[model samples]
Each structure stands twice: as C-alpha cells, then as structure tokens.
Target: MSRYREIKYRTVTSFQRRIGNPILKRLPNQTLLETTGRKSGLPRKTPVGGRRIGNAFWLVSEYGEKSQYVRNIQAHPQVRVRIKGRWHAGTAHPMPQDDARARLKTLPRLNSAAVRAVGTNLLTVRVDLTN
Candidate 1:
C-alpha cells in the first residue's frame, strides 16, 4: 500500500467505525454479519451489504484479511448472518480466486458502491447458509 492509500484507508475506516457503522447497524433493513471475536471469544456484529442466493449468501470484503470479521472467520469459520430480520447460521470462506469486483456488481447497488469506494484489497466471502 502506498502512503496515500494507507492514509485514506485509515481515515475512511475510522469514520465508518465511529459514525457510519453504529447508525447503520440499527436499521431494520440492514444485514448484519456476526463473527466470533478471535481473541475475546465474543460475538461481534457489523453491518454489511450482500445478497442471499438459495442456500448461500455472498459478500465482498473491502479489506480482505485485514478486516476484523475476516480474521475472526479465519479462527472460526462458523458464523451467523442476520438477513431480513432473521438469523442464519453459516460457514464463511474467503475465496481468493474469486473476482471481487464482478461479485460486487451482482450484489445490492448501495453496498457495492460503498465497497468499491472504500475497499483497497477486495476479497470475496461466501457463507453457506445452514438455515
């Protein structure tokens, strides 16, 4: 990462963490990704944008392994996602070979746009819904 991109990433993510996320997580329509904290062993939820197709939900992480939730999934693949107000248990997998940009285009526009805007290391994550 260049100096400029690194600074930008820190600034943008800090703003989102302190402001955007808290509000977004409260919205009824927002989908929440729940991952167990790798160290604390507590559930942590983050607002996310994705689509549910059949028995799976697809999402692209803007920061790949650098993301806290992704790191959590690395330690524990089992996760829970809140979609349309219902919770579904699933296993999260990071698909390094997947085309993250192309995958984003297939997701909800608002989220895809945000992900495109702030994401540096785009990564694909697929969760197999156990329902």
Candidate 2:
C-alpha cells in the first residue's frame, strides 16, 4: 500500500472508531453487523450501512480484512445482523472477486459514498440471512 493511503486509513478509521461508531451504534435506526469476538468470545456490534436483498445482506468493508469485524468474521462465519431494529442470523462470506466499488453502488448512498471516499482496500461481504 502507498504510504499516503496507509496514513489516510489510520486517520479516518481512528476517528470513526472513537467517535462515529460509539454514537452510531446507539441509534436504533442505524443498521448493525454483529460478530463474535475472535478472542474475547463476546459479541461485537458495529454500525454498518448495507442493503438487504432477498435473504442476503451485502456490504463492503472499507478496510477489507483489516477491519476488526472482518477479522471476527474470519474467526467465526456465523453472525447476526440488525436491520430496522430487528435481528437475523446469517453466515458471512468474503467475496474478494467481487467488484467492491461497483457493489457499493447497490448499497445505501451516504455510507457507500463515505466508504468510497475513505476506503483504501475495499472488500465485498455477503451475509445470507436465515432469520
């Protein structure tokens, strides 16, 4: 990765982790992706922006595998997602072959735009909802 891109990733993600996530996670309207902590064995909920299509939910991780939630998914593919204040069980899949930039076009606008603007290593993820 370019030095500039690495620096930009750190700067933006730090702010999002410290400020944006804390506030957004509390909003009932905000969609959430819940993953089991890889080591802690606890639930980790992250405010996310994505679209539920049929029985699946799609999203792009701005940081790719580096994102904590992505890492968690790697440890345990079983996950839960909260959309419209209700929760559903799902299996998470990382689709490296998918065009994340193009996939973002099919998701919610504001968050997708932010992800495009700030993302350095975009990666697509699909969660097949079962509940």
Tens digit of lDDT per residue, candidate 2, span 2-112? 999989988988998999999999998899999999999999999999999999999999999999999999999999999999999999999999999999999999999
Candidate 2 residue-wise lDDT at 54: 99
- Reference-based lDDT, each prediction: 0.94, 0.96
- Provide the TM-score for each candidate, comma-separated: 0.98, 0.97
Query: Which pairs in model 2 have colliding backbones?
Result: none
Task: Give lDDT tens digits, candidate 1, residues 1-131.
Answer: 89988998899889889999999999987899999999999999999899999999999999999999999999999999999999999999999999999999999998899999989999999999998
| Clash counts for the predictions, in order | 0, 0
State the displacement of the C-alpha of residue 65, model 1, in Å, after optimal TM-score superposition: 0.8
